[model samples]
Target: MRCAARRCAGRRRRRRARGGRWRRPRRRARAEEGRGLVRGSSTPVRGAVLLYGLLAVGAVTWVLADRGTIDLWRHPEPLWRFPFAAGLAGGLVVGVVFGRIVAWLSRWAVRRTRWGAGLHEEFHALLGPLPDSDILLLAFLSAAAEECFFRGALQPTVGLVAASLMFGGMHLPVNKRFIVWTIEATVLGFALGALFWAGGQLAAPVAAHFTINYENLHFVRRYRPA
Candidate 1:
């Protein structure tokens, strides 16, 4: 009788999931979008287009304005050393450590502050509908494109402070409680700038940024449903 009861419950749960319980969170996120609490259209296709468009712009800007040179670094190298292999390895390590730090801080915020919890929910709502594959793609693209544009092309043109400020402004808050994201991004931009300056190439900042995004976005995808 107990075994039969367990089977019945499992069947009922599957039925409920099929009945849309599994998609409730996504629907709720869409509803929030309707209400204007969420920003931007969050579809995977749109996201890809936007990222690629930025990448093209970066490439063009890099060719024209910067004259294809990177004198902004503390020790600028010949463009022949494009990969910067050592910096990539070191930046990967730094990215992992920084990701853990940010994760710890985010958890603390969610647990300790009411606003933090709400902001967390807000991100979920905005990002809930993405498939796991899309999360990975977006993570890589966003990191690569952002680092290319901000650290690679723009920094050499405008200098660190100006470039970092623009990067921060690009991630401005969605709401009052979400100001923390903007501040965090700004600090991260500067850190990435330092990495660029030290490593003397775009590879380090791109690798580090990619690691951080992969960590955080995968975490978001794996978050327990509320």
Candidate 2:
């Protein structure tokens, strides 16, 4: 009877020890999951705040700059009558074509070269896991604010070349992708500037910008690696 009691006590002790070992790992895993959830939730908030902040700043700057020079409500018709409907249709077509070409080139480059793949991955990381809705909003707001400031305000004052250069330069940051991004931005700036110049109104460039951004955002979100 004494021997049986002693064995039973030993078994109980061993079981408790085994249970404790399993419980510790389970607790650690739960803590890690909680941390991941917090990070995932916070990232979108930060991205939205940054995008909206840019929109607000751009809007204020445009308002201040164009106070008397360019009336948002009125513009003298160009000698060549580029109707608003025609401009909108043209902008949409051009924007879609341009966006498709850019996306195809980017994807091709990513598949072809290690450097391109690395850049693609880096950009994906930078964008994070933004939802489709947030991405759409960001693209639209960015297009509107940037077009208002660059095409609506700055281009008229500084001329197309200067405005486009400034637009390109604005993208330069102390990063590995700065030069590439700057060049791409410069080219895009020129295209948008030309559209603005041709249409003689903010509508064309704004539509084009929005279209390009929206398409690109969707492409990146859909094709980015898991």
Candidate 3:
């Protein structure tokens, strides 16, 4: 009877020891989880600060340098004499379709990667969708301002490849998809820069930019659940 009692006490002690061990690990795990949540919460703010800070610096430098603000003054030189508005309306229609295509591509790429879905989802959530009017205005302003800085002034002041690099870097703040996004922007930047240099006016890139946005924006947003 005494041996059985001792065995029972030994089993109880072992269980208590095991319970103690399990408690520490669970506590530690919870603490680590809390830390992870805190880090995740701060990442977006950090990303935003980094991005906007870069853009602000770029804008300030542009203002101080007095580079190509006159390009903004150069209004849209539509083909006034051509039949059917010289394809202005048609070009814009194409741009809308193009924008949707790019956005769709971005969504697919982002969703497929390991860390990409979070970046893609958060980007859309934070920035929200660009309204039709806003997209139009942004395309115009971006074509003018961006062209002035990147293509007109910077390319001539610097060089083609160098200007494209800066242009891509400046967008890195607003871009979430990292290397892929940068690559896409770089290609577009090179083409847009080339067009601006060739045309000596913002019309071509502006139309193209707006068209791309119009095309892709709809496709990207199409996936959103009703």
Candidate 4:
């Protein structure tokens, strides 16, 4: 009887150990699931905020432009000098090419450096798992609003270099990667500013901005880890 009782106790211990092993994984899965839910729920709110903020900026820009508060075209080229169609086409090409080059460089840096990799991951985390349609709309709105304000209104007043620097500075959130992001934004601003200066209209910079944003977002959505 004593031997039988000892054997039963050993079996019970073994069963508990086995149960614990299974329960740990289940608990971890539940925790991960909960986190995912939280992230998913917050993405729309972020998107909405971004959309509205861009819209407000665009509205202000439009009002200023209408009121002659800002000169979008300082040089005031003849209509024949920078034809809308030609400007749009050239801007599209430049944007696509520049965007691809930047994307390639980013991929290379991510692979080669820990800092690059971390920044890449951080960006993905901030974006979360937004739907493709929402991302597309966000991209469009961002391009339109930003170009209207930055290239259209601010660039003419501040000059290209100052405007580009200001654009970069605007991106410098109080974060670990503030410098890196600011530098990146500065470089992009230079490109867009050049487009605006060359084309002497909002169409060029807007087209370029839209193309770059659309491509970059799509790339992130498609290539980022599940």
Tens-place lDDT digits, model 1, residues 1-226: 9999999999998998888876898998766544311134366437665766777576556746657553332224432343557656666776667656666676677667776677777777677745555656666777777877777777766788998999999888877866877887899899888777766766567666776666666666566434
Each model's Cα RMSD: 8.3, 6.8, 12.4, 7.7
TM-scores for all predictions: 0.68, 0.67, 0.48, 0.67
Higher-TM-score candidate of 1 and 3: 1
Which sections of candidate 3 miss by over 4 Å? Answer: 1-120, 173-176
Instruction: For residues 42-98, write the lDDT of model 2, one tens digit per residue.
Output: 475455557656755765566566565435311233324566787667666766666
- Provide the lDDT at 172 for model 3: 67
lDDT of 3 at 88: 44
Q: In candidate 4, which residue ranges exceed 4 Å CA deviation?
A: 1-80, 224-226
Off by over 4 Å in 2: 1-80, 224-226
Give the Cα lDDT of each candidate. 0.68, 0.66, 0.55, 0.67
Q: Report how far residue 41 has shifted in candidate 1, in Å.
A: 11
Per-residue alpha-carbon lDDT of model 4 for 58-166, expressed as tens digits?
A: 6466647655554443225423355667766766776667666666776766677776766666767777554655566666777776776677766666678997998
Better lDDT candidate (1, 2): 1
* Superposition error at 43 for model 3 (Å): 18
Give the Å error, residue 131, model 3. Answer: 3.5
Q: What is the lDDT of candidate 1?
A: 0.68
Clashing pairs in 4: none
Error of 3 at 33 (Å): 37
Cα miss at 194, model 1 (Å)? 0.9
Stretches off by above 4 angstroms in model 1 are 1-45, 69-83, 224-226
